[model samples]
Target: MNIDHNDEAIVIVGSGAGGGTLAYELTKRGLPVVVIEAGGYLRNEDYVNDEWEAFNQMAWLDPRTTSGSWRIARDFPNLPAWIVKAVGGTTTHWSGATPRFKAHEFAARSTYGRVDGANLLDWPLTLAELEPYYDKAEIAMGSTHTHGRKPLPANNNYKVFANGAERVGYKHYSTGPYATNAEEYDGRPASIQDGFNFQGDKNKSKWSTLVREIPRAEATGLLDLRPDSQVVQITHDPTGRADAVLYLDKDGNLQRQAAKLVAVAANSIETPRLLLMSGSPMFPNGLANSSGQVGRNYMRHTTGSVYARFDQPVRMYRGETMAGVIADESRHDPDRGFAGGYYLETISLGPAFLASFAAPGAWGREFTEIMEAYSRTAGLWIVGEDMPQESNRVTLNTSVTDKNGLPVPNVHFDDHPNDTAMRDHGYRQAEVLYEAVGSTGSHRTPPYPATHNLGTSRMSARPEDGVVDKWGRTHDVPNLFISDGSVFTTGAAANPTLTIVALAIRQAEYIADELRVGGI
Candidate 1:
């Protein structure tokens, strides 16, 4: 199967937040767009009520050709990192905790100086530059949280941190903004706020880019979605410009999609892998690898969870994955000896079967007893900021191949000393919050394995420092663009979906403008 040269469609790979939003935005403006998603399309009915099933849905079942297994951290083996491959990508199973990156987050280098062994730099685009896009994304995705309108939510855990911050005379505010709908907008339902029981009932109002953008994009005849099409490589022209992508359809047929512009929306880990696989004479390192920054500067939002069992059941199961969050601490303070901020929030507890594995104590009668005791316990998560390091990188492991006979992403990452210190500080603060809430047996998960991956192809002003420019266009390959977490220069403490959507929306405008002008 081959797409004709005259198709007049922009080909987008990976239909997650970035690709999905791009497809919607472009098609709405009457640009023909072809979206290729490795994962099949799934509907709300496809979501199972069971925690294990829900967790499993977070990944692509086909191990080969997909990065499903590549997300796991090899060094520390027990933890499971979640990423999705379906048309919605990871947004389907995402915790739906959407918070905007702070204004200072975009200028970490200038604000806090610099850190050793880190590539902290000011984004080419400032918060004010992206603010309009953020608002556009919020409107497009039906974001829910109140921005600077009222004080942040005051759960028992956040109250403790707020009081401490107040006593210390530090400026603290609510987690600024969220993409989940605060009220019904754009025909999407309102966000329902229950306690910690996310598995209790499904909230249809929660806006996932899949549910929000894909449908809108599909309604336009300009957009066509091809699910289960695994892209193998990008085809580049002699000048090192990507002109098309080569992929395999579900029937194992080779297909080449030619587009004047190509956007790689695969997430941080896979985006770089795709580029590296697309080798050419003009780009021996890889397509768009003139600076050798294709797969560098890897980062993930390092997270730590503090668990506590209350005497009275706090209704541990209730609403979304993260219903309420404490944003007062989401800022970097060099005086505190750390360059990271943390967003603290409550998390869902798995059902009995999965809870058995998380339960403390040895795998004997003691473990069983512990499981019984904490079955209804509530937990808090400290999603902390991570500084992007060039060394903590993603490279293709030729020795390892998944089911698709493709090399898996070999991720090499270790927490920087300051990162570890920030995590420790956040853990101590979480312990304090638990104690303040009158909970016993509060403890942090031992060194969380990286899951929220970002920054593999960081965006900057120049090709020397990053893979993409401020507009998400590759510096080396002018026609090739990236729209995903991979373009982030810094990983904020917040869940990255909202920011990813905002950036994709911003990229869409740039692409639309370039198309209008017939410019590369």
Candidate 2:
């Protein structure tokens, strides 16, 4: 019952939202899949309720360097991303907000017009084209407020958020469209409101790959889920098609897995790093770098945080970490002093994290005063569409070698003017919302380690424009694909999980049809 190293199987890298969902979908369709995860397999019960403890257990702690004008370089210099490395990937630690990309978001290039210092391109596919997959993804994830699924009850934080939005005359505020179940639909229980999910949801109430896709995939017996298998390179035949993957196992031994098809879903940084590392005579630069776009146009959504402290206790952390969202500003209005827009969603951080991220190296009366108002704080995250620039990218730091003696990936970024404008506008609007609710004071926190990493392997209508085609197939290497946020054309003003899952589902359907007709 073991999959041989020489099996003509579909090999997938990374087991996050995209890869895990694809594995389940393809396995159910009766195809063989080998999912190689670079971290250990931890079940729901293994999740730690404590914030710092859980962070140590799940966060991708690999050595990564950050070089950017962004505040993250000054705050979290070593940790560029706050993603999980475990079996379920970052889905085990996401906030579960499932907002769909707006129709205009797909055509950002044409809709927003040309902005200086931005490498904007319209996505090859539109919202209308992917709407059906989004529906299927929502149904599969049992997303609340969609397809008859019940919405989650508003917590104290949400009540405050909704009140503030109402006072500010803003619409489109809601408790869901979230992937977490509200009334138990897919064998997982409803959210118990324990509020430890951002740490790691131990209750199994939240939907994650550990609680859903990975298990369903295992049940089909067509899955070979290998944890602690860090891929070093992808091997290709003289014909320039991917044929094998070279990885280092947990025991520090190198192993090669033969494949008929290879899907790279190792997030944005690692996915492109692997592609760049897998250089050969056929591809002097990298496997999919013929367009010179393998590691370019890298983007992390424009982000900031605002916390308002009122006179009375709101106990924001008593429920979900992120419970509600306000979509009023998630639009493109040139008069607003920005090219694109953002969303304001309720966010709660445990005291330890707040102290660390709210102000990285601050101490004194000002810092102490902020921490003292934890019980009275109502916080919101501003996630906006950031312009993608060709210079904002991930590159191999040949100067730094990893544990396996391979050059480590260095993430380099510089915030575009559009990003700064968007963030400033979002922050100003947030202050108005809080002031509308009679808040005594508000604190604005700079960007933290990125969670919504996108691009680096984007889709394009032409081969010279990007790394992948609309179907996520590599332009230079036909049998190779990207199945994560790496394939995002432009980062829309929404959480990328739902879309990543939707695209993975769509890719699965295409791969299935192609396998049937020998197109691959």
Candidate 3:
């Protein structure tokens, strides 16, 4: 089904949850696709369990500057996004939480009221409209506790965490809704409950595109998965329809892949940066920057962490990285002193990351004491909805260039008052949550480099508001699309991967149907 002729195949950039899922879906439907990824095709067996070793192996450690009022600017000044630059993208490093977005979260603009200094916009599509796709994505990903996928067994960390949740009167605490397999399902084996998997799950229990979609797509024989192909520019014809993608191959040689349609799923930072770098005379600002919103409204979820030291050993790092989540706080209660909400997820950072992130530049007996009590520490991450500020954005810094002499991206973020308030509330709630478990004391870790980068080319109902429409097709260029978190209109409390896959599945259907009808 590799349709031949003058027209190019559908080109999908960045083979992560979104792009990889789209490739499998489209190819399985008899449509040919060419996926170009910037990272190497590291297999499941090639994964390293060591903290720093895995970090070096899979992280997108390119030169990107950070400048903002956020602590990450002062702490991790060189790394803005903690995403991966491989075939599976950040799915390789994700904890596999797959909770769905609440209905109200979709209509943030209408529900959250007009918050000052926030560029809030309701998504072009609703959860009700996407519910079927969400179901499909869950089935495809084998999300635990969904579609009869068994819940992952609770380890000691979750046992401690759940007991605390119960004592604190939080109702929605559980072992899963995660994508990692609890039992043998979909040809993937059950989890081994090893601590080192989060850096990169070698056992293949975690649902990642590299483990699932890419193999299936390749088996279909209609998909071409090219690794180490860093797409730099999206070129267009005179009519402003995306016609081809120019990328640097593995050998650092320039190459161009003609495209019948183009989908940019290059995470949040690189997606907008690529667009800005591809500016043409027709679209001076960027390829799809007609609304001047391509690089604006950047959102990384408001995040923080609380680690507590108990009298006895908790050994939090003995099981899955994020084993339990307390969802009681993930609600719209502005009376709690914030417009949005956050979830308290059980998190475990290996000693290396813990020491580096727990206290960036601290020294003394107190810091040494915290390090010494690593085995007795229990950790919980605060993941919350962050306001999309017009000022928080990803822009190319011409002052700094990459290996290819291209301008490196400069991420600028200033926490909104709402973000600050919500983070503070989350920290307070987390400390209290830990206290419920009879913890001696706790330390709140500042936000690390962003894991859930979102909304750099957001979806909006109006052309004047964003880069893409409901189906992820760019409003300015009909054939261009955004298939990653970059298309998120508002950053919801839930992790974005499940939604990204769901949206990509829905987008594939839309693109396939449109192609059949000559709409594209």
Assess every candidate by TM-score. 0.89, 0.99, 0.98
Sliding window of 10 residues with minimal summed lDDT for model 1: 63-72
User: Order the candidates by lDDT, highest first — what do you get?
Assistant: 2, 3, 1
Tens-digit lDDT track of model 1 for 107-208: 888886868988897889898998898888776665555432232244443343444444544464343244445556666555565532233224556667
Alpha-carbon RMSD of each model: 3.7, 1.5, 2.0
Q: Looking at candidate 2, what is the lDDT of residue 455?
A: 97
Runs of candidate 3 with Cα error greater than 4 angstroms are 1-6
Q: Which runs of model 2 end up more than 4 angstroms from their true locations?
A: 1-4
Q: Residue 162 of candidate 2: its Cα lDDT?
A: 92
Whichever of 1 and 3 has more lDDT, that candidate is 3
lDDT of each: 0.72, 0.91, 0.91
Which candidate model has the greater TM-score, 1 or 2?
2
Candidate 2 residue-wise lDDT, 269-318, digit = tens: 99999999998888989889999999888899999999988999999999
